[model samples]
Target: MRQALRQLAGRVWWYPHDEDPDNIQGGVAVISDPAGSVVVDAGNSPSTARRIQAAIEAAGLPAARRLIYTHHHWDHVWGACAWPEVEIIGHRAGARILEVEAQRSWSHHYLRAEVEANPRLGPSFRGRAWAMPSWEGFTVVPPHTEFDDDLTLPGGVEVRHVGGQHAEDSTVVAVPDAGVLLLGDCFYSPPLHLRQAGDGYAADLVDRLMSEYPEGRYDWFVDSHSPPRSRQSLRDLIVSG
Candidate 1:
């Protein structure tokens, strides 16, 4: 998937999921600096981490000094264990989710629910369909650094505090000066995980982003499940502009 959709927005690049019928996006943002390169948001799976690393290599950046998880969710943080050398960073709120949610969240939601729902999850899930993995081996670590409102990241990127509407710990990395928003599951085209438990908060988050940010002027809008529904939802807001 990273091979198929490696679209770059200045210092940041996106890798999308082509194999997924759901068309979710799991990407790494590469922002280069003299110090080194920083990759944002580790992908959902180990395979995804490999692809993202390959893409980063293809982009011609040296080994990344750090990786940042946009938010702490199974699809986002699970793969961090795949990349050990890179120092991970996130907001305090996100850091807690990584630590507190308990691997139980991962077991109940991802390993159990999704795969049992479909075999496309992988053929390895054949007879052990009901079998689930334990998060016992998993180690959840908090972000080394936490920020309150807005923080300027390398490459002139602004990591903004998008507090309301989305998950209680949602974070939005906005290149406001550049008109790009690296939203982490805030808004997507067909609506990423729309049917999940946080539908009401998710809906509010959608309204906030659409009403707050500018329209197509932004060069790119990136998200974990960055879907077309995001475009349409924001387009309505643009009309009011």
Candidate 2:
């Protein structure tokens, strides 16, 4: 039960989903510069979106002018409905996945299942029922701009489509100046060493990441659910995987 925005790098920040049990485990990242801020991933609900927005404002940073969806998971992109004006960015396949999930009312069914699975959180989240935003009221808001290959941001940051083992639309964002690379659920850590993409894993994805981001290429490496690591550590994980 914690809610705090952590500054990871000079201009990078992370909002750990702690206090809100319903939105637990879905963290959000933000990369800010003079131009504006780029949000790595949105959380599971509008309340989470508002919290991230407040954190950004409290830090005296600029508005979240750009959003990068790491993948099509509900926890990652569901918060976009709160800010329809922002320019969302992600791989084309990611947009397609969102569309399918929206049509099927994914969030409602998913939350219900989670309650049935975990009696602890099933009781309530922040004194409320463990429920997500209404599927009808929620929209999958596809990326305003979609990319097939890699897209270089205004500040030399690169968002490359490296879907191999994770979701086919999985993207790895690299901040050249900051020497930080963000891997969004492409590589699962710990006991669950396999990729968590519902679509299944792609064996060569790790090899591709290794070749693209060798040692010394990045100083800090961040994944969707794990703590940040050094360049060598990340590279080794890929190799060992």
* Alpha-carbon TM-score of each model against the true structure: 0.67, 0.77
lDDT of 1 at 90: 80
Give the Å error, residue 51, model 2.
Answer: 1.0
User: What are the per-residue Cα lDDT tens digits for candidate 2 across 127-165?
Assistant: 222335344566667788999998998877689887754
lDDT of 1 by residue, 1-241 (tens): 4373344655555666444544333555666555666777776555566677777778676667777667665566655766778777787777777667544444445544666686455432321222223444444456677776667766676666675544555677766554667777654322233344434334556557656776775645666654322456555643443
Off by over 4 Å in 2: 17-24, 106-136, 189-211, 232-241
Output the number of the TM-score-best candidate. 2
Question: Where is the poorest 10-residue window by lDDT in model 2?
Answer: 188-197
User: What are the lDDT figures for the candidates, one per model?
Assistant: 0.58, 0.71
Task: RMSD for all candidates, in order, please.
Answer: 6.2, 5.3
List clash counts for every candidate, in order: 7, 2
TM-score of 1: 0.67
TM-score of 2: 0.77
